[model samples]
Target chain A: MYKGYVVDKALLDKDPHFKAGCILCHAGNDGELSKEKAHLRMLKKPSDNLRSCGVCHKKTAANYAKSLHYTTIGQRTGVMPRFSEAELKTFDEKVFEKSCRSCHASCGDCHVKGAPVGGISIGLVAKHKFVKKDEGKTCAFCHGGRVYPEYTGDYGGAPDVHYQKGMLCMDCHKKAEFHGDGTAYKSKNEVPQRPACKSCHPQGKEAKKETQVAHSLHDGKVSCYGCHSGSAYRNCNDCHGGHAAAGPGMILGRSPRDRKVLTTLRLIPTVRDTFAPAGIKMEHFDAVPNYWDTPAHNIKKRTERTRKCDVCHVDRKNFLTKETLIKNGAKANEELIFVPKAIAR
Target chain B: MKNRRTFLLAFLAVWILALYGAAVFAATPNKCIQCHTNDALMKSLHKPPVLPKSEGEG
Candidate 1:
């Protein structure tokens, strides 16, 4: 049997997904003997159109249709602030619809086969089995660019504490997060079911008195990633049209979403000329900062900052400053620069 | 002898009908799997993945 296309003949009688025959979802001539005649107009990825899965899994399919993974509307929301009314219209038509929307994940991408990233795919998740969850193949393939690599320490220093404990993407991020609760949320931040560090590790639950004191002191002022980001994470620079060169570095700055809170920030590749190829000038380029708060995946039980308060309060290590800021970045970037005050003994 | 002959003819008819029913109405081997499961055929069709020139970070 072939590696990817091998289907266990035994499953034909057992699995209901296959009971209706391959023709039920993958529309093709099952009666045709020749390969050429059989695959004529076959839906290579039947679940691309949710109706294939929605026919059986009504609720999950209906919810997944509106999920951030499916709609990918967060991409548009991220840069919408920088566009003028006419520019927004142009971006919607040219850049977003053409480039960004293609990244949306379909139902089959996770359950049946791995989604193609940059035009390369792993073909099938298993031997054509409808797996409940295969984060290593599915999540790792799509998020491999940044998050997954960092989580596993392939991109940098020690692997995340959670990975060391054998936790995966689905551990914290539950099924409801992937299959929406019937809300057409524009950004993932708006999703009520999104994973938060505090959800699992509550503040007052620290084992040691020292740890408990630290958590209380920085509870609202600092984000968990601000101190726990293990090492340098990837930062993209100078994105033009749809391409950007990535580098390794970690930047701690005020959260662009909530400036009062300090958090791990990643440089967004959007520059003034980012949409120029599509004839967009991004008239209000200074409206949004180039850095955005990112929950860095390379978390550790003990980091340089966590080990010593001096890394932040005294040395102010990894903090974003005006000089370290990207040249030709938006003027709004200046607002994100923050200096941690020294602790008084 | 006539009774025995009649019984023999009925059995022959039943056997033939069963064979015809099995050929026409029984489950056919899934043609999709027939070619897909052939390793040699898939290997012959395999080509190196071509990376797209697009600006996707993932």
Candidate 2:
């Protein structure tokens, strides 16, 4: 590192203390650079490595714990019962050489200032040429056909390029915003200054004012989840719900037709059901101490918690604006919102 | 009868040890104060560092 061999001379002068060497992220110092010693570094468990980096990103690691990645491992007591360790070890030997570069892709490779053969150039970044077949390759490794399914009869799935070619998970999965143990609190407004939805749909305000364009426009009311994630929309269901949000939104026995009336599924405190309401059924909108004990965060009871609406009377301030409202046609006032931060990010 | 009672006690001890091992092993909460007491965790999880009220809202 002191020799400052391939590192840019100008860049090094600017940031003198920059630890620019393999030893920073990897192990084995003596400059031997043996393949066996490099692989020995893998013996250090992921959790231990996480502790080293957790100091820099305290909040992000906590949220990652609650996410699907950690949750899957946690549920099985850190064991994949279906696949034996021996079988996986054998499979690793057969297919690993061809697949390792793609499936277990790391951030170090992508974010490195300048790499060789696959350096951080605009062309390489644009095409995501780092991993030959990136998304399908990584997701399918652990997640079966349901995810990046190469099988037939998996009809209602998005085309692979959406996850593969498009802005992949790394683009949006905010670092230092998740916990290692895997529990993401809803309080984290990704863009507290702005919002998440408006990032992709900047002209959403104009869209909300029109009947045809606005997804929120239902019979006469707005499906807030279609806009701000209310009702059936809960947690991180907005983007990941490629299929109909079948997790929390699965109403006990209600059929399709009954959905409209039973739409407001209040999380009324209940005995731990055999299936749903696995743990404590705390209200969605947790109390902001000293403010009020109003039950917020529930699908059916959000607007009442967040905003005062002209549900019965005409909001004279918004007649010209609220004209687009399908249900509250009488309401003269209305406002629209989206995840506004994506624009700035 | 004496032998059966001794066996039962040994089994109970093993069972209790296993349960405690699982619970404590799963939730390993370490304190950063070991090396650096001043960290963001202290701010987020620790009691607020504000002066106690004296008289009232003066």
Candidate 3:
């Protein structure tokens, strides 16, 4: 390793980037042989600035600038629908920048260095060599806490069939979604390239006729994860104050975006004093549950609810209600409590 | 005494040469503009997004 950066022989000998030399990307004095002087203004991650990557990949950089990964607009918009106009302005200017923005992925954060999340920065993603993508170290490094673990069955549930079949995030989520198609969408829902369960599993393609009929009953109303997600998933609470005060749990509720849809509800770490640093306190702290319409990654082809029709249809106890919520702050999440309606089928 | 003086001068010359050799023989120019000034390279270097500009002191 040269000064903590592993010198990849292949990259040094073959890659154009290495041929261009280190000083081209990492700025500093090449004339000085002293380590300190050579690294005076060296950029550990040059790709953090679009200019570094844009020189060769202009179109991708242009589209990526507007992508959700860059702007984190989807996360910003998710909370917008819950707050008032006055609160939103303060949130945009203060709370978001202080608390949420750091977690948002930058281009270099993925393709070059490890993401800086919760103030923890891992080593370089690929030892200063620019990579197109490395899902394990790059994507999982940030998403490791919840999504990655659940996808791999590390969270005590059966792994997603897709993951078992060796499908990476890039497999389902195409390049357009990552680099963006030049549309500034407010949420992932608004993106035209957003992945849907229906996209891969179309009607009557592989599913049985009975399964199609059952899906149709709740078409456009419920997400497939509502019933198909078999195991308990992450629903964090009280993040601003204490880190240990949170753990994963399952909760069901009406989708915040679509009221009629009963979907899997995960409590985002937005609490009363969530933005106390910015001097903004959420007024309706307990008025509504901070349940966002979450796409729970833990999915099973056959689940408790899908094992048989009557398990969900007749079992009122299993449904989300005051009795079923096990966590401490769950009672406050009144809005997301699933209610049973008469099934016409 | 003459031999000692010759040894000292030789050591000094070697030290200076070792320090300056790598920089002088570097394949790429030490100047930033030498490579960055290339139109093809510069054109590809696109401008970054206008992120929320704040004091970041918050």
Candidate 4:
């Protein structure tokens, strides 16, 4: 009746989710009066199997099974470049399956209840009610460390313009992005319908001539976040043996994915010795840069760079340099360093 | 008159049996909720939080 296991009696008759009785999803001896007997074979998270919800939601369950959120293949793709064939095999068995894949979200995690992060849960989301979407309770728990906090401005500076306009994660990131479009994408970058600034704010649509000129000038040269990132976002450092340290920073640099484009970047936590604990020396450590281009969640309408062009073209502030790079990082990180040119007056 | 009396008696018997079945179905409580709804029972059953094996990505 209190926290984790409370079920509203009123919803028992009203909601179809409960009509089949708890035993249908959560297998247990409902006939037994003794507490221990009744809970003997009960499933703590029935949705972990997906079939529990799949019985009624066939299409969603089938698509979700291949979704990045459910499969968590993106984590493996990000780190695979650093590993050799044999090392990757070892990593898949030892680290990825045992650790990363455990983080995948199940049906109940978002709908019926909040997922258990770090073995702690918020319990039933609304007295066991099956909600369509509840970003605050569901998304916030997993992304609380960075994205959510950055979006809400709870980490440091003002909240994102989107958040100020009363938008949640699902507002921009559509349900199909979470539910999957029947493609087993290796990484989120390959997701076709993933949220992009250009999707909402197309170029040349700006009412102000100055804004239109700025967009036109920076079309392919600069990324939206390069100038719009409002404040310092979290940069994770040195993750080894499943532990990582994080710090706030605003790093502007050449995109690792495309050096021609300048954008906001964040320091990845992987280091040479990051996998050494698991006996992986990372034979190809330099293959991937330590700093990867990030779509910083803390976006603003006007930032220091937007207000004064001199901030970037003249002073070249926040631009990554060899001197500012993390010590003992991969040599590839040097490639991400970019220097801005002076503006023509 | 005899046939009419027999039909009435059969109708009453079937109705009584249906009511009995409905009562029995309604009385069968969901055992999961029976214990979970008890505040004191749940409080007593609560265990200490388990330590996480690893800190996952955000």
lDDT of model 2 at residue A177? 31
lDDT of 4 by residue, A1-345 (tens): 147677777888899988877898888888887878888888878988988889999999999999999999998999999999999988998889987887899998899888877777888888788998999989999888788999999998779999999999999999999999889999999999899998989998998999999989999999999989999999998755455788899999999989999999999888888888678889999888999899999999999999999999999899999899998888899999888888899
Q: Top model by lDDT, which number?
A: 4
lDDT of 1 by residue, A1-345 (tens): 135665666677788998778988988888887777898998888999998899889999999999999999999999999999999999999989888898899998989998887777888788788998999999999999889999999986678999999999999999899999989999999999999998889889899999999899898999999988888998887755454789999999999999999999998888889889888999999989999999999898788888898889899988999999988889999999999999998
**CAPRI band for model 2:** incorrect
TM-score of each: 0.92, 0.28, 0.79, 0.92
Which candidate number has the best DockQ? 4
Ranking by lDDT: 4, 1, 3, 2
In angstroms, the error of model 3 at B6 is: 46
Assess the local accuracy of residue A37 in candidate 1 as a C-alpha lDDT between 0 and 100: 88
Candidate order (TM-score) = 4, 1, 3, 2
For candidate 1, what is the DockQ-based docking class? acceptable
- Least well predicted 10-residue stretch by lDDT in candidate 3 chain A: A1-10
Q: For each candidate, C-alpha RMSD in Å?
A: 4.3, 24.4, 11.7, 3.2
Give the Cα error of residue A148 in candidate 3, in Å: 1.3
Lowest lDDT 10-residue stretch of candidate 1 chain A:
A1-10
Give the docking tier of candidate 4: acceptable
